[model samples]
Target: MSFTSDQAVEALRAAGEPTRLRVLTLLAGDELSVMELSRILDQSQPRVSRHLKLMADAGLIERFPDGARVFYRLSSDLAARRLVDMVLDLLEDGAADQDHVRLEEVRREREAEAAAYFEQVAPRWDQMRSLYVCESAVEAAIERAAGPGPFDRVVDLGTGSGRMLTLLGKKARLCIGLDLSQNMLNIARSNTAKAGLDKVELRHGDIFATRLPGQSADLVIVHQVLHYLIDPAAAVREAARLVAPGGRLLIVDFAPHALEQLREEHQHRRLGFSDAEIAGWLREAGLATSAPIALPPDTEDLTVTIWTATRAETAKRSVA
Candidate 1:
């Protein structure tokens, strides 16, 4: 059954229950047979099956027939996926002692798998660029924040395929691309080199806790990246941490909407953020914030927002 926004909320409320969350944590990797889940979760198969059935009916999961057994996996519903990701992220900081270790191990395994998958797929970055057509928003935000100039230090967080670096190549004295997947970084590095951006640096790292020195960048841009983060606020804080005084931070991502299907495929953290939330985050990071500018109607399902904020002069003075 297709789930709407309201249904997505209800589904999340249902799955967000304590026990049900434990079950999902175990099932995140792949479809788990009922018995396998029961063994892992230490619950009876009947009880586990009941919760799975409810999630399935809620469009949070799907059961596929494989011979005589049915395998349950995450659903393709966007809302369901977002709900799941948000719940998982929220639980990350305060999860139970036992589950925290398990979650960490699972996350490491998942990251490794995702990295490997991206590496294998890196060569196709150029072909995949056209999949998202509205790159103008990203470009506009960057230009508005940092005027055409030769910046000595710049960073593009989550620089998928390094497209933005290519755009800003001539203008940046040193452009660095940071992302989590080696494959994406490899593609980005290759693309940067291909575009003759020999000074561009590609680093595989998490946006939330990158190795880049504090207050290191003259400009930082996180384009179409925040939505994929499990904790966007943390990532924003990190971006703010890295910007030098008088430097700018630009973020372009989807705005909050009712699309629930994005979660399963896109792994979006939140549908998007409200203007107030985005502004508050920038302000907390000591940045002078502005109202989010909404993008043109491209797809009926998703809306995008771009924010440009600058570090406060006081911030620089205090750091100095």
Candidate 2:
């Protein structure tokens, strides 16, 4: 990917500054809100916002809002990412030691908060699963849909409890499980180790921006995670971006229910999703989806649906 001459100069001008360069360096690993940026940089929120605005306007970074908070990350465009990466590569190591140290502390605090919540909920997850539906039935359906394969690389987004990793571990050469909660990651680590999945790797990461290589995963699984996201379609697009050409993405979630209780109690941003809605999202992400397989409970519990979408072998490479 190549940028226009003018765009190259513009991106450079945006990143050429001292503060903006530090911002790019910090964002390379994870997305940060303006408040977090301000805390790490020890700059006023207004000043940090100003730096973010310049980088965003120059296309060196992307800005998004979640509720009342606005967040920024390195640009998702291929050419823009390439330029930012090249510029950051020129900076000497430890160029801003203080900034790096503060950044680590801010991230740790965020993880600790998330860890506390997960720790409180992790024990009840199995009980919740049983209340919603039969856990064994869901696992069997996922395993059958995933197919027995000697996959090169398998990625499990929102890998909570590492159950999926244990199920798919023996079928893959490598297994990577990502979760936002450090406590959940610890659980997954223990569970996978007990299962003897020596090749499994766990990361505290965002599903929307994994930073993993594009088109490298033979299989990508997003099991029962979309309901918690503010934008389920965006999650699907990000998951699809990781699938290798001709590879498949498997999503397991609810099939549209009137479970109003789940919304308030479970932190569900969306109650459930319809098959057509999910298929549309997959299609928009440049994947062809087949009919979804639904497993309903005997009572009025939530019904779990599994949707598998495939990318054509001739599909274009992901931008990032």
Q: Give the TM-score of each candidate.
A: 0.65, 0.64
Provide the overall lDDT of each model, using Cα atoms, as 2-decimal numbers.
0.72, 0.84
Tell me the deviation in Å of residue 139 in model 2.
1.2
Model 2 compared with the native: what TM-score? 0.64
Cα lDDT tens digits, model 1, 149-206, are 6788889998888988888877888999998877788778778888887888888788
Q: Which pairs, if any, clash in model 2?
A: none
Q: After superposing candidate 2, which stretches have Cα over 4 Å from the reference?
A: 1-116
What does candidate 2's lDDT look like per residue over 137-175, in tens digits? 889988988887888899999998888999989999999
RMSD of 1: 10.0
Candidate number of the best TM-score = 1
